[model samples]
Target: ACLSRLELSALKFISGLNSGLISGLNLGEEKIMSEKIRFSVVCVCLILSFAVMPSGAAYAKRELRGKIYMVGEKDEDIPSKNTTIRIEESDDSDVSTDTAAFRLFIKDHYKTDETVTLKVEKPGYQIWQPVAGKVRIPANLENYHEKVRLDKLGSHRFMSNQAFAMLIENAARESTKTVSKSDEKPDLSRYLKEWAVKYGFGIDDVKTEMDKWAADIEKRQDNLYELGLAAFYRKNFKEADEKFIDMANLPVDWAQTQYNLADTYFAMEDWAKAAECYKNVLKVYPNYKKAIERLKLIREKR
Candidate 1:
C-alpha cells in the first residue's frame, strides 16, 4: 500500500511540472505580441511627424514681405497731419487694417523699393483699390520711429538709406497739403496724351499707329470675303455662299461695288435679277457666288 501511494505522488508531481511549462511558453508569446504592437505604434507616429512638420517650418523661415503708400497732389498734402500712412502686404482691399501705416511716415518721409501694395482708406474718403508703389526710408530715421510705423501695421522687407532719400524727394514733390476737397474731374485723357509725349511718342503718332492696326484688320477680313466670293462665281456655289455668309458683317465696298448687289438678287430667288446681279457682282467681286448660282438656277428654270 505504501509503494502504491509513493507512485501516485510521483505521477502527480510530473503532471504539475508539464502544466507549468506550457503556461510559461504562452506567457512568452503574449509578451512578444505586446512588444510588436508597441513598435508599430512608434513607427506610425514618426512617419506622421516627418510628413507634416518640415514644410510648415520652411514656410515660416522664408515668407515674402513688402510695403505700401498713397499718391496725392503734393508731398506735404499727406492725408492726415496726425494720421500715419499704413503699409501692408495683403490680398484684401480693406485699409482699416492699417496697422502698418506708421512705418510709411517715419522721418517726414520714407521709401521702399520692395514694391508695396497700398490700400488707402480714411474716415471720409472712399476705400480705394490697393496701389502698387515703392517707399523710401530716411537715414536719420531711428529704429524707434520705424517701430512706431510698424505699430500702425506697416510691414517691411528691408530698411535702407536709398529708400529714405526717395521718400524725402517724393514728399517735396506733392503733398496732400496742396489738394482741395471737392468734386473735381481731372482730365485723364489729357494726362494720357502727356504721358505718351513724356515717353517720346507724340499723341498724333500713337493715333496713327492705332489706325494702321485697324486698317490691317479690315484688309484681312476683306481678303477672306473676296476669296470666298471668287469660288462662288466659278459655279462653286457651296464655297462661294460660305465666303459671302462668313463676311455677313464685314464693312467693305466691293472692288466694283456691284458684285454683292448681284449676289443679293440671286440669294432672294429672283432668277432673272439674280442672274443680272450675279453678273454685276462678278464684275466687281469677279468671283461673286450669286452670279454662278443665278446662271445655273436660271438654266434649270428655263
Candidate 2:
C-alpha cells in the first residue's frame, strides 16, 4: 500500500516520539528536557501535516478549471494574469491568479440552471461584467473558458464607475473648450461622437442625456457646425441639412460647412445638389483634396 507524504511524515514523527519517550523514562533531567522538546516538535509537525492534507484533498476535488484571455483590438488573444476571480455566495472561495488559469472547487455538485455571480478585478483594466464588473456563471458547468476584454483606464470606453467618471470629466473638458474663445475651435462633433461611442448613446437613457447636452450646446451660435455634424452622424438628415444651411449662411468662413453639406447631399443621393455644394467648397477652399476627388467622381458619373 502506498502512503501520502503527509501520512508518511506523521508516521515517522510518531515513531520518533515513541522512541524518545521510552528513552527519557530511564534518563536524567537533561535527557527528559531534550525528549520534551522533541515531543513538542513532533506534535507541531503532525498538526501541520494533518492541516495541510485536507487542503490538498480539496484542491484535488476541484472539478472546474478555467482559462482566461484578454482580447485585443486586432482580435489577438493574450493571457490575462494577476486577476482576481470570485464566486458569489461561496465563503473564502475567492482566488487570485498569478497566471491566466484558475481552478474552482465546490463542496457539492450544482443543480441544473444553478448560477453564480463571478467578479474579476485588476489594477488598470475595467472589471469584467455583462453591464459593468460582474458576470453570471452556470454552476453546473465544468472546464469553462472565458475571453475577457477590459477597457483600460481613461480609455474611450470604460466599464467601471471610476473609469466612466473619468471619461465624463474628459468629455466635460472638451465641452468647455467647444464654447471657449480659443484661437482654435475644438471639434464638438468628434467630441460628442467619442462620448456616445463610449457611453452607448444608442440606449434610450443615454440618448436622452445626450440630446439634452446637445440642446444646451446648440444655444451657442458657434456650435451650430458641430450640432449639424452630430445630427448627420445620428442619421437625422433633415436637422443636419438645416444646421449646415444655417452655418453656411453665417458671415464666418463656410468652406467646412459647404463640404459637409455636399457629403450630406451625397448620402441623400442628390447628386446635383451635392455637385453644387462641392463646387461651392472648391470655390472657397481651393486645393481641397476630397472636394477635388468628389468632383472627378461626379463628372464620371454624369
Per-prediction CA RMSD (Å)? 27.9, 21.9
lDDT of each residue in 75-160, candidate 1, tens digit only: 22222333324445443332222433333322222242234334344432321212123323323333322111111112121112
lDDT winner among the candidates?
2
| lDDT of candidate 2 over 1-302, digit per residue (tens) | 45557767766776676676566364576576666666776676668766766565455653445655564677565677767766655742445375677665544655433444455666655533333433334444454554445545444344332233234334535554566564443444565456555444444444465555555546653445556645644546578778768766764357778888999988887889999888777544433446867977888887
The TM-score obtained by model 1 is 0.23
Cα-based TM-score, every candidate: 0.23, 0.30
lDDT on C-alpha atoms for all candidate structures = 0.40, 0.57
Estimate the overall C-alpha local distance difference test score of candidate 2: 0.57
Best by TM-score: 2
> At residue 240, what lDDT does model 2 achieve?
70
Model 1 lDDT, residue 138, Cα? 28
